[model samples]
Target: MLQSLTGVEKHNIEKKQAKALFESTLWSDAQTIGVTISRGFEWDTKHIIESGWEQGKQMVVPKCNPEEKSMQFYRLNDFQQLETVYFGLQEPKPSATEAVSPDQIDLLLVPGLLFNTNGYRLGFGGGYYDRFLANFKGNTIMVASQQQKCESIPVEAFDRPVQYVLTEEGMKQSK
Candidate 1:
């Protein structure tokens, strides 16, 4: 299992490679999706926005309040319209961020500290996403560098499973 954070240079390279795979496979048919901001130490997701743009699909991002342990997702209809919010992550207008109704989204690209092909993941010791995903109705996919893959990740009872895992190597569905 890979531990510690990946360096910026290596992370960027892996992110680019994984993004390329994501673009070639799903971008062509996906019409709507949600991605998360690449906070420090998190996987980069700017390419999801670019891929969404190329496909003319609607892209959404999440605004999270660690204090409240809650999240609001917004459609990235226009990048210029986004404004920086808490923790330097971009969020749509107040009205743009809305509660995610189950299954309302077609896809959700997730980022995590560690994961395995079976969909098990270890987050940053926070239950925020694990809880938020309890009700999400969509195909959750994990995007991370090859180095993030682990032989096994502790599975809590409340953990949510992903539909697939995307890495620099290619795509692998959770088994």
Candidate 2:
């Protein structure tokens, strides 16, 4: 079903999703936000980052630390600084060395291929976000389509649940 949203349909849904996220108090109140660079059919977060920049919010993106089996958030001043890495995904350069502490981030925009209404998500099987969120103390929000919210998905002990989810339909609290 994920393949069904194409061309104009995908663009329109992404726009609506971005708009809904923009209108949320979560986005408005955040000073520093942790978000990922979307690839493929993932919700395009470029819109959110651009909007956040316009709003004067500090934008941060993750750089995977494979050795540690974790990810770290780095403050991104410009999208031009990101380079495609880690299995063809755009990430902040290692030279952009300023690390943003987890406590310093007011909101974290988590990404997932599939999510359950219960808040569990099926990631790229890296467990990077899971490790990061293990100690992160902030609001966790995911932008996804209603279709991605499934009835159930396999979960592990280390899996973490997001506090909220922002879909094209609207934002919903996830337990």
* Candidate with maximal TM-score: 2
lDDT of 1 at 82: 72
Query: What is candidate 2's lDDT per residue for 110-163, written digit by digit as tens?
Result: 998788888888888889999899999999997788888887799889999898
Residue 37's lDDT in candidate 1: 66
- lDDT for position 134 in model 2: 94
Steric overlap count per candidate: 1, 0
Estimated TM-score per prediction?
0.79, 0.95
lDDT of 1 by residue, 56-144 (tens): 78777777777888777777766675778755767667664445553566778877888887887887666767877888867777877
Find the 10 residues in a row with the least total lDDT in model 2.
Answer: 1-10
lDDT of 1: 0.72
Clashing pairs in 2: none
The true-structure Cα RMSD of candidate 1 reads 3.2
Please tell me which predicted candidate would have the highest lDDT against the true structure. 2
